[model samples]
Target chain A: MITFDDVVKVYPGGSTAVDHLSLELPTGKTTVFVGPSGCGKTTSLRMINRMINPTSGRILIDGQDVAGQDDALLRRKIGYVIQHAGLFPHRTVLDNVATVPMLLGKSRKEARTAALGLLERVGLSAEFASRYPAQLSGGQQQRVGVARALAADPPVMLMDEPFSAVDPVVREGLHREFLRLQKDLGKTIAMVTHDIDEAIKLGDVVVILRQGGKLAQIGTPQELLDHPADEFVAEFVGRDRGLRSLSFDTAAGLPVRPLTADLLLDEAGRPVSWGDGEPTGGTFTVEDSLRLVTDLAITSPVGIAVRVDANGKADGLVPHHDLVDHLAERRAAK
Target chain B: MNLSYLFDAAHWSLTADGSIPQLILSHVWYVVLALIIGTIIALPVGLYIGHTGRGSFLAINAGNAGRSLPTLGLLMLMVTLLGLGLTPVLIALTVLVIPPILTSAYAGMRTLDHRVVDAARGMGMRPWQVLFKVELPMALPVMMSGFRSAALQVVATATVAAAVGLNGLGRLLIDGLAVNDYSRVLAGAIVVAVLAVVLDLILALAQRWIVSPGLR
Candidate 1:
């Protein structure tokens, strides 16, 4: 866990970057700091490792003050990933990932061995190990950056818009991989980004900051979406936040009706088409999100979503009106 | 132009003091010594300035000043003050070598992607480690180009040593001119030009070997 104890950062010329901000990033979870430009999200992230020291107040990592620790030693213990990956252009990918371990006194052979496994874990092949950062594309380089950060197995990770530099398609892939890696490692991660949709997708706890580095609100993604603190946050989360919140809930408990005769099925019991051999829009399983189920239902020509089982066999149906009723019931229960 | 002097076996003799072989050796000796002295004096200063961004004014202006100062005039002035010997010629040649090396080192450090340095620091590398492990290796291409130019300049200019009673390939030119033997003078000029090109080629090969292929 990291705690900011009334931290303030005023630049030498008297411009305030962070204004007496106090917050706690919980252990073993991802906390996202998000806001517009000049909100000090990046500044606050840098202060954790003393890259930019706070003007006043202390930042503590697991109850120990970062100010008292040596800069290099403290930084070594905290993994950091930035927008462009910031790789050493001269070093091969293997050596780049091996940097932290080698700096911490591991032998070159040992470090390289560990680095090979890390590259694989990050979805890079052994062929890429000998290649330099320039030989790889933007998305590939970012993976190497992540691999390098994890080389020392640091308990805390700081990310500053790590996925922002890539194209949208590559960013989506990276986001999925990142979540999977985080699920397994569970490092105490603090990331900063300006995109609220990203904050909603990745953050366990979202910290919204105002223009002057002041905290606007701090809560879970659903909490922030459902109950914004003010007009700024409401506008920031966007107008369709209610629809977006459906992503968090699954369609498991929603009632489904028996499949009708018009729904055609293959020999293996999979839904192949609707009435008159017209193809089915799509199929959703019980594990799928409410959002996916709602989308399927609304888009289906016959106004019903096919519910499939784990084996892809059509089992039940969810009509559009039933989804509305289910949503209304959920609101009443809330 | 009498070409007969260059073809004479007596002038090519290894044992003779003023023969082509002996003159080439002396010429190489002057170029090597001047380069060694100049690098020893300039490389560290250049690296320091580049690494710290201090003394930038000195780095920027030193190259122009060093280039503009006439080597012949400096050698004559040194000879007048210190008496005629190898010292004055060496001092002049070493002066000619410093500017390129120092300026190149500074430019190399300045042009580095700052983000790479930031990543290095953030990865827990000590200041010296960052210099040796990251900055120095990356800056080699620029530093080497500077060193090559310095060597080329020193090779071409070391001929001035013959003006101060020093034995080198320059002797062929100075002695030839004194006796009106155009063949010997032409031979000296050709040898010096060839030596410069050969030295530059060797340095280019060295740079290719040392610098990371990734940069290319």
Candidate 2:
């Protein structure tokens, strides 16, 4: 766990980058710092690794005060991923991933051996091991960056807009892969991003800061969406928050109606078409969010959502009215 | 015009004082001496200034001053001060070789992406490790260009040393002009030009071998 107590960062010119801010980030969970430009989200993240020091407060990681520790030694034990990967252009992909371990005094052979496995774990093939960062695409380079950060297997990871440079499609793919990776590893993570949607998607606890580094809100994604602190936060979360609030609720145990003749399926029981024309709806699995289920139901011509099993076989459907009833029932139960 | 002198048996003779082989050896000796000493002095200063960014005014202005100073005048001044010998010639020639090397080293370090350096520091590399392992390797191509420029300047200018009574290819040009042996003068010019090209080519190959292929 990391704790910040009345942390204040004043630049040399007397600009208060971060005001007197105090917060606690839980261990083995992802915490995100998010805000608009000059909100000091990036500044606050840098303080954790001592890249930027708080002017008059204590930052403790686990139980020890980070201010008194050796900077290089402290940084080595904290995994850091930044924008554009900031990869060493001259090193091969494998060597870039091996940097931290080698610096920590691991033997060359052992570092390289571990690096190869890390590359694979990050979804890179053995062929990419010999290639340099320049030879890879932006998305591929970002993956290598994540691999390099994870190479040391540090308990606390710091990320500063790691996916901001990629295209939207690539960013979405990285987002999905990040969540999956987090589920398997469960390292304590602190990330900074300006995109509120990203904050909602990835953060276990989202820290929204106003300009000058004052905390505006701190809560789970659903809580932030359902109960914003004020007009500023409500406006910042955007208009789709009503739909976003449903993202936390799973589609499982929701009522599934029997399929009628209006729906069509192929021989393998996969969705083929609906009614007479093209299938307007997409498929959602039991494990998907209610937001996706609601979208699939609303977009279909027959007002029903197709439920697919792990094998892509259509098992049942949830009509639009049934979803509304389920939502109403959930609100009453809450 | 100098073909006959180059082919003449007397010039190639092992015992002749003004022989082509002897002249070439002396020329190469002066060039090598100047380069070694200049590199020793300039490389560390350049890299230190580049890495720290503290002495940028010195780095930016030194190359121009080095270029503008008259080599012949400096050699004459040193000869006047210390008398005519190889020492005066070498001191003058080494002065000519310092500017390009120092400037290029400074430029190389200054131009590298600061983000990359920040990343290296954040990854826990000590300051010296960042300099030698990261900055130096990345800056090699630029530093090498500077070194080559210095070498070429030294090779071409070492000819001036013969005017102060030093033995080198410059001896041919100085003595031949005095005696109207234009063939010997032409031969000296040809040999010096060829030497400059050959030396530069050797450095180019060395750079290719030393620079990281990933940078290319």
Candidate 3:
């Protein structure tokens, strides 16, 4: 777990980038800090590893104060990736990814082996390892950047708008990949983004910071969407946040039920198929949260959406009423 | 100095005990020797000033002063202080070449992306590792160009050493001027210009060869 206790950052010129802010991040989940540009979201992320020192207050990583640790040693234990991928242009992709491992005293052969494996994990082929950063496309470069950050397998990763540089399509693809990786890897992550859509899509915990780096609100996507705490968060989340609340709920409550139930049973007594097409995304299995069901419905305007089986077969359906109430109940609870 | 008159100049030197080969060899050796020594001595100075981003306090003032010094003027004065011969010529040429190299190296290092530096640092690079592995690699292309300019200038300035009694292509012009041999003057000027061109081309090739292939 990473905790920031009354942390603040004041630039040399006396401008406050982060006010006296405090936050806690649990292990094995993603916490996203998001705000407009210069709102100190990035500054907050940088402080976990002491990339930017807090002017006051203590920052603890797993309850250890960073001020008392050797900075390089501290940073070596926390992964970081930046907006442009920050791959060293002169080094080959493999060498770039192997940086921290090599620093941690791994043999070159061992580090290279680990790096190649990570490259594949992040979706780059081993053949691309010898190539330089300039040779990679923007999206591929960012993947290499992620691979490099994970090279040390640090328990926590701090990223500053890692996907913002890519085109919208690539950004979406990366977001999907990141979610998949997070599910599989379970590393605690703190990511900063300016795009509210991204915040809602990926944030297990969303921190909305006000203009001067002060915290406006912090909650799960459902909680923030349902009760914004004030006009600033409500406006920042935009007019459509009511709809945004539903998806988070779907992931939790509405797992696909037995098709034999009163909801939308078909000839085989299954949720009716739109062929093999899924209605609520494939996430609504007996395993998935109702929040997943809600997101699938939002993806399509039709009143009913199907949930898919592991083989992509339609297993069950979720209706608009069920999705809508999930969000409403969450808001009322807040 | 007439082009038509230089044929007579070569004949004139060739007939004077065939001294042309010996003279050219000696001149080449002196200029190349100074260039190598000057580069070695100046590299650390240049890299330090450039890498630290504090060159303005010293590099700008010193380099401007160095650039403005009349090299021949300095050679004549050094002839008295260091006492004429290769010593004065080497001093003058080395002084002439260092400033361009130092200032350019400083500027190149200073202008590099700070994010790149931070990334290297954040990756657990030692300060030395960052310098050798990252900062130096990026700064090399520009620094080499500076060295190129310095070398070309050194070649041009080396010809002026005849004032200090060093036997170089300038010997031809100075002797020709002393004896009113216009043919000799024309030959010396042609040789110096060609030598400068050749050295400049070599420096260009060195740059092409030394810069990383990606940057090239």
Candidate 4:
């Protein structure tokens, strides 16, 4: 866990980059710092690794004060990833990932072996190991950056807009991979990004800051979307937050009807068509989010969403009206 | 123009003091000595200024000042003060070598992607480690170009040593001119030009070997 205890950062010229801010980033989870420009999200992230020293108060990592630690030592324990990967242009992808391990006193062979595994863990093939950073695409480079940060197996990772450099399609793919990796590693992570949707997608906890580095709200993605603390937060999370919040709830609890004869099934029990027409909309599963189910139901020509089982066999259906009723019940409970 | 002097086996005798082989050795000795002294004096200062961003004014102005000071004039002044031998010639050649090296080193550091440096520091590299491991390697291409130019200048300029009673390839030119033997002067000119090209080619090969293939 990382704790910010009334931390403040006043630049030499008297600009308050971070006002008196206090927060706890829970261990083994991702906390995202998000804000408009000059809100100090990046500054706050840097403070955890002592990249930017706080003018007053203390930042503690796992109960130890970072201010008292040596800059290099503290940084070594905290992995850092930034936009553009900031890779060493001269080093091959494998050696770049092996940097921290070698710094930590691992032999070259040991570090390289560890790095090769890490590259695979980050979804890169072995062929990429010998290649220079310049040879890879922006998305590939970012993956290598993540691999390098994880090479030393540090408990804490700090990311500064790590995905912002890639295109949206690539960013989506990276986001999924990042979440999968985080699930397995369970490292304490603090990431800074200006994009709220990205924060909502990746963060287990979201911290929103106003223009003057003041805290606007701090909560889970659903909490911020469903119950914004103020008008500013409500506007910041956007008008479609209610619809967005449904992503947190799964379609499992919604009432489903028995698949009737009108809905044709394949030999494997997968939904094939509705009456004489093909299933116009895609199918969802019980594990899928309510938002996806809702979308499928609304888009289906027959006004029903087919819910598939684990084996991709159609077993249930949720009519559009039933989804509306379920949504109403959820809102009333909230 | 003077093929006879170069082709003459008698003039090529290694044992003879003023023969082509001996003159070439003396010329090479002067160039090597000047380069060693210049690099020792300039490389560290250049790296320091480039790394810290301090003394930038000194770095920027030193190049122009060093260039403007005529090598012949400086050598003559040094000879007047110190009264000759190899010292005055070395002093002038070393001065000629400093500016390019210092300026290019500074420019190399300044032009580096700041983000790479930030990443290095963030990864827990000590200041010295960052300099030697990251900054120095990246800056090599620029620094080598500077060193090559310095070498070329020194090789060409070391000929002036012959004007000060020193033994070098320049002896052929000065001695040839005195006796009106155009063949020896032409032989000296051809040898110096060839030596400069050969030295540059060697340095270029060294640069290719040392610099990372990734950069290319």
Q: What is the lDDT of residue B149 in candidate 3?
A: 84
Quick one: best TM-score, which candidate?
4
The alpha-carbon lDDT assigned to residue A183 of candidate 2 equals 97
Considering only N, C-alpha and C atoms within 3 Å, which residue pairs clash in candidate 4?
none
DockQ of candidate 1 relative to the true structure: 0.75
Name the 10 consecutive residues with the lowest summed lDDT in model 3 chain A.
A273-282
DockQ of 3: 0.49
Give the per-residue lDDT of model 1 (tens digit) for A122-168: 99999999998889999999999999999999999999899999999
Show model 2 residue runs off by greater than 4 Å.
A261-280, A308-316, A331-334
Off by over 4 Å in 1: none
Alpha-carbon DockQ of candidate 4: 0.77
DockQ of each: 0.75, 0.75, 0.49, 0.77
Interface RMSD of each candidate, angstroms, one decimal? 0.8, 0.8, 1.5, 0.8
The sequence of per-residue lDDT tens digits that candidate 3 reaches over residues A163-242 is 99999999999999999999999999999999988998998899999898999999988788878899999999999877
How many backbone overlaps does candidate 3 show? Answer: 17
B49-120 in candidate 4: lDDT tens per residue? 988899999999999999999999999999999997999999999999999988988888888888888888
Please write out the lDDT profile of model 2 over residues B1-216, one tens digit for every residue. 547877788788877777888888989999999999988998898988998999999999999999999999999999999998999999999889989988999999988888778888888888888888788888888899999999999999999989998888899889889999998888888889999999999998998999888888
TM-score of chain B of each: 0.97, 0.96, 0.87, 0.97
Candidates' RMSD to native: 1.6, 2.1, 4.6, 1.4
Error of 2 at B26 (Å): 2.4
